[model samples]
Target: MSGSQMGGAGWEKLRADIQKSQFVLVGEDHGIAQIPLFTAAVAREFKPAIFVAEVDPYVAQAVAQLVAQPGPATAYLRRYPEALCFFDWSEEFELVRTLRAQQVQLLGLDQVFITTSAPFYAQLAGLVKGKVAKSYFQRQANKYQAQNQAFEKAGNDDFAMAKQPQSAIDSLGLLTQQEGPAAQKMAHDYALSYTIYQKQAHQLRVNLMKQNLVQALLPYQTATGPAAPKMLFKFGSNHLARGLSQSVKGEFYDIGNVVQNLADIQGQKSLHLYIIGKQGERAESDNPNFPAKRVGTYTVAENPELLPFLSQVAGPAWSAFDLRPLRRALTTSKLQLANPSLERTILG
Candidate 1:
């Protein structure tokens, strides 16, 4: 995993933390190629029993099964186009393959991606026994085909699931009300995701994520069983902050906060790490309809607070800064910053 961009010092620090912590969360910028390699390395060192990611639960199940098969990644994608999320990126696919190859369990606890609607509708149509319900699902799938086309041309979320008419949502709810447990759960989560997106309800979304996390851990928490399973989480930076997450207008407790608190309750430790490129290219878009194209560049130097870390980054290779020293200094009142904003960003 030398290509991971992490230097020797970074790996040493990471190994030490992984040894001490029951939970490790890696908060990252989404599109970098090196982050996946770095993540794969961390998975090797941590050997987590569960790896939580930022995709839907159903998508996670499909990915786990897909990588275990003996075939090219593209073949699985071609067979179930638009059925998977982040794995469409080759780097991301390799990361999942590495984790699954190590026999690690994966749990996805984020809202369904934008590409999820049509294939999901098609699957539901195939599963439902009622002719009326099947027809409704089929029609919805066809409608999404048109919506996707228009979305591509417009490059807007006007066709997002959150914008679906209320009557259509009510109809969908009615059809799945009496289905089996799996179908009902999918339908319920699907609708709730839509509501969360429409309202921009960060707290509600994090609540659902926490609920999923708890549900995933329940089996490992039995009184007669061994200690709670070791876990590693990968998500966008904002979702994994140790305290109240930073946002445009407000702050809220996120999954990182929950994981840290969970570790505390279990009489163990959790390590939170944030990673980003000092200056490099990032994917132009997250649109799953097409192959990811890297079209833009970003520099962390734009933010003065990030400059301290970016200045230490050498060349194109990955560098890691141990924030523990800075955190400790702040706690002891040995470090003081004239910029209140910088202090908040670092302390958080």
Candidate 2:
């Protein structure tokens, strides 16, 4: 309650590192209210030119437009409750509004959500020429509506896009061929994402995300190969680790590692922080319709190196542990630790 969103030496240390780092990445657990609060504080301090989000590219575009005017966003959510994924949370909405107000570029680089198909199709419909094509897009939009509704009611893939007929998919692909470049790109990404989901292709999904990050930054690059705009990436912990992701058993280098390499090319550093609740009741289910059914305790300080930071988590305030020094200690062999695996987790 007293610090910079929870003040003390730890917060000061983290802020100092943030001041100097070109990229500040926050890997967080979903369904925590304090996360948005703390992240907003980081936004103010970092003043990043770009804010990378966890949602899909089109959804990010929608969020940027919706948050520009607060009242319409609320109304739109009421009608299409799951139109946006992570930002559907009230706290996340406020955080996006904060970033929008600061004039930060919001970039979403992930797979499209099932419930957002209707809105995405509507966007595609608006971009194309001619009445017949427009009508076709509208019909697809309606199908998406029906599919989403059925999936929500039964919570099954039986009614999902993955099960759609091959002919239907071919028709859409053919329609996109007739559309403009912008519409074509959207359809291509969506189709690739659909295939990934259908096959449960985790590596392909990660590769797509890396490609999206490159595509999002292309405009800023030139013949001279200048650095990308200063950015703050907010994603799940698994997606933001430096080298190997625990989720993938050390097989994949995710978006966080991608950003790190980019920063290294520019002779700058990317700061990655993993944030979670000290202890609290968390949402049992991501769906808003699912009632809060249980209380849980979450913490990331079980390791001895993290114990100092744990003590800084005072009532109603958060804590920040600057892992850079600990990371340095490991690389330089300043601290004697016998376990190699524990060293990697701490370094991460």
Candidate 3:
């Protein structure tokens, strides 16, 4: 596989190509911190028109609005931590701050809420009125209370139904036949489907998320914008990869595939950049002054083969290493990433 280090003239080559892309999906290992630092640099250089996030669209939109209005970023985020829980204090926060500083647009595409959906559902329930819808809402409210009571009596923590309410909108047709206002039925149906099937449900949510993302980015796909609608999708590896996911069932259409298909249909270009962590449990370096050692962050766990090359990676970050020279140094070398397919998947 042909690869280039991120610095020197190498970064210039990657930047030239990346800046031309209409849609760019960058994969991440979620819990890692250094990944965001690399991404921040990319965003600064790439200056994509918009950032497509792996968060709830509704909450993401709200946060985007908040970010655009001004005020402290962290304070605003902490005020409504439920918008996208995982993104709260993680490197995502730094990403958000950086993008906001660059005046980049933020669009969240996921439908699932990390915490309880009751708050959002309650708002939807309030928008309509009718016997069926009211009854459905009342019943669900009572059911939630009973469940909490049961857990209290049993000396257990109250469990929440974290599932999305997409089915309720579908159920409106059936509920309306029960002889009530269509508006009420719509609300009632959505509330009823707030149950989880775990794996299948998660798969469905991700598929729907792709649709949401494509729809959200469709307008920006036009020939306008400062530079042909450059967009960056920062998501988990499973959500951004163009390959099968053992985590989800059925035919999974991840965000990357969705964007790729969309770009193809529109005669545009997209790139899937997957970033992987080291393959093993390599301890953080004890050398505090090591230039590559990130402050308060773990070091990339190098695989056995990369162990010899690990010394080449400085403390600042992987973005600093131009892997091209390293690769040329050893023709027999193959990247031993946690995601074994990454090197072949991209640089190949």
Candidate 4:
């Protein structure tokens, strides 16, 4: 544990730890711009082969395209404000750009991708062979296009499509089967992720997401097997933990479990970091109009209880505390802050 101003010592240790590892799970308060700014800084420092995010694969692709497009970011915002609206955080625009600019391959670990990017599934209708499967996706594509129009016309309530049917799922399987090798790429691509979304509708969401992570990361494995492609997985802490979560209401195996397994294979280290906002004037965090560049930071007298525990952190309001030492010594360091507002508790 150290002060937020531990300076070079903090980053030296943090980067050293990251260098000795295969996957880093960075848990953050949802919609906090500060976290993403810190994340961009981490990515700049670590330069991992892949940056895994708790984002839709389609949205990631869209942002990449927008970045490469001849127009400004606002063009993207106007056409697909839903992407930013989904997270309700404008600052993520920087994270997307940072990762893309760094040439770090972006992988969206979430399995659910439906409705929001219908054009993807719709276009898949043209790519896949076979009449029956093609017809099924074609119909779905048209329906999704109509839904998009209606959503825009009705002021984009932000919810466009839902409830993929068994028939649609079955048809998608057949479509992928018909497409063969091409379908494999499509299945993992923006369009086919919806099929995954539909499939994971009932399963523990993190399970499929971990599976997706495994598939994307397998290529980075080396012959020596001690080191694989380094990765940073950022998501809500709930989605990164393992074992049974009574709150989530099921037996859950998340990214933490996935990384542990990866460590077992590569013989590397893995960590499960839980972030909590402690002792600050916490307001509602997910503001669409908040600074798009970074989460705003303000000064506060560091609390005595926290001062002794947290190491140097980057964000203005929150500091990065190395909890690994504490995890080894204490069985639990329950971080539910005493001040409720500072916690930035979110419900999804």
Candidate 5:
């Protein structure tokens, strides 16, 4: 009902909603530091018949193989080239380890549409093929001018106050609007080339959905009487919507979109959706209003059980590995789960 209650009370309601509905889709804000913990909590609470993540299917398959055959977390981390910069495998690996320990079914939801090289080539080809489309060029030019005007306006407003000049914002605006036409032409050409890629992506997406659904539903399909009441799908927020918000009708087709499309294709009409976003300076007010409850915003705390394992690996270096040492200290000293009251309430 309120922002504070969104994490705990809202999550409890979400679990309940998932239990009674045919499907539940949880969307997440990107790089939300709290998401790993939130996801781990949801998996534990609902013990959802199935769990999925934003990981690509190929990567997922690798993860599945690794999950099935337990090994060092480092081995698993090596598989993802994209994760090297910020994500240490330990954070997510711990969740995978926990889920496997709990015997939860995990699925990866990303489907690759085109090989990375081909799309780059196609985009380059499109840019060289013609005089940049006139309309596209004009739109880009107008966007550049408008952005410049906006920066000047913001600067003027800030200057009215007796504050130090906000050169950073002004500088960033300059950087963003520089090379207006060439940038626009490149972007438009890339988009034009991407149209071909999108068709392939869509087809791959459909196939991946069909495959995942078949596997997820296999248990129920083989069972007699009324099947299990519900399922929880964990995927990137990107996959939850239809597509980028800019495209016409493209706004409607993500994993949630895929689910709806599947339901329509199969003539079913009853599934529920639940999405989660991280709390930030922008505030929840900036988020889109979907027809679901707002769960509370939470920050991730290290799972206590994980520390001993980490300690074993890092040895004398354990302190370095434990980023939130206070949380870890509280967890270890208290000999308690973090936020037990909230956890119990949600699990209940």
Candidate 6:
């Protein structure tokens, strides 16, 4: 993708696009320290009434409570380390602080119950608990050990012959035709394992939806005006897909499915979804696919609107913004937009 310049006019256009929308989804590339700055900038421009984060409600509630108290915002970081996993502390703190100052309600969209253990245990129970699940896990361990031993032997032979690090050679060997069958077998086994894990994750996601719906409805239930103009949902692209689908094979549910289910239960069609993703990286087959198009690039001169905001936060000196990095960011933002196909399914 070519790096194009976005000027003040471009920023205004982007702001206009955001203002006209009822929902804005911002997808991100890899979890980099700078990504949150862009998120905050966009949020500042749009000023959505609600900011939905990937963090679970339990953590969000705790953080929200902490924000309500008067002190350095960084103080809350020490209390909840896991919440920092999604974004850098300083950027996230700034975003949270700014949002709170503006009185924008923060909503937690992730399910609280979907722990790593839940899926493993659920699968274990399905496989017959102590008898089948334990045996399966043990067998899996043994198989991995054998593979590791073989890989080590191959690495040793390559290193001995070439007198260099065997990492690249080892990686190449693993991707060769000889390894294809083994890779397929591993994939199949992973699928089976994932099936068990997904059941538990799905259950947790459903529970989260129930809780979020109740919370979001409270204000509307009490009174009614035109209703909030827009909502901004910030989350991993995976959950925003057509349903609450995990990357685990058959276990994935596209966000679309979740929305349809919600509409069926609520008897409402007022919600609008905007899926967003950033560009810069090539799309991986495993990643959630979306109807994506280039939305231009972010250049230092073009987005001068961001200059003041970026300056306020500490970061690397701003130079010419590379188109590749900006594209990657935009591609991610596009993916966050709710899938239109899923939306159609629900509305129809």
Query: What clash count goes with each model?
Result: 1, 3, 10, 3, 9, 41
lDDT of each residue in 186-281, candidate 5, tens digit only: 443334224434444554454456565655555655333224334556554545542222123232244566565544544443233323321232
Per-candidate TM-scores read: 0.88, 0.86, 0.61, 0.68, 0.42, 0.44
Instruction: List the lowest-lDDT window of 10 residues for candidate 5.
Output: 282-291
Off by over 4 Å in 4: 1-16, 70-89, 130-139, 152-158, 163-177, 184-203, 222-226, 242-249, 278-317, 331-348
Model 3 weakest lDDT span, ten residues long: 280-289
Q: What is the lDDT of residue 300 in candidate 3?
A: 43
Off by over 4 Å in 6: 1-12, 68-80, 83-88, 113-200, 221-229, 242-248, 251-348
Instruction: Please give, for residues 53-131, the per-residue lDDT of candidate 4 as tens digits.
Output: 7776656666667655554566444444354333434456657666777787777766434545455565577777777
Residues 104-157, candidate 2: write the lDDT tens digits: 989988987756767777788898886777888888877877766665555343
Clashing pairs in 2: 3-6, 3-7, 4-7
Give the top-scoring candidate (TM-score).
Answer: 1
Instruction: Output the lDDT of residue 175, model 6.
Output: 30
Residue 272, model 6: Cα distance from true site in angstroms: 9.0
How much does candidate 5 score in TM-score?
0.42
**Segments of candidate 3 deviating more than 4 angstroms:** 1-10, 68-83, 129-159, 162-199, 217-228, 243-253, 279-316, 319-348
Better of 4 and 5 by TM-score: 4
Write candidate 1's Cα lDDT for 1-348 as tens digits.
367545576678779888888988888888777788888888878889888999988788778877787654675444444447777677887788788888888889987665667767777888777788889998997787667556645554344474577777677789988777766776788888888877888788888998988787777775754357888899987788777674534667789988888877788998888877788787655444433443468887656667776777678666767777787898799998776545555655
> What value of lDDT does candidate 3 attain over all alpha carbons?
0.55
Q: What is the C-alpha lDDT of each candidate?
A: 0.75, 0.75, 0.55, 0.57, 0.41, 0.44
Q: Compare candidates 4 and 6 on TM-score and give the better one.
A: 4
Is candidate 2 or 4 superior in TM-score? 2
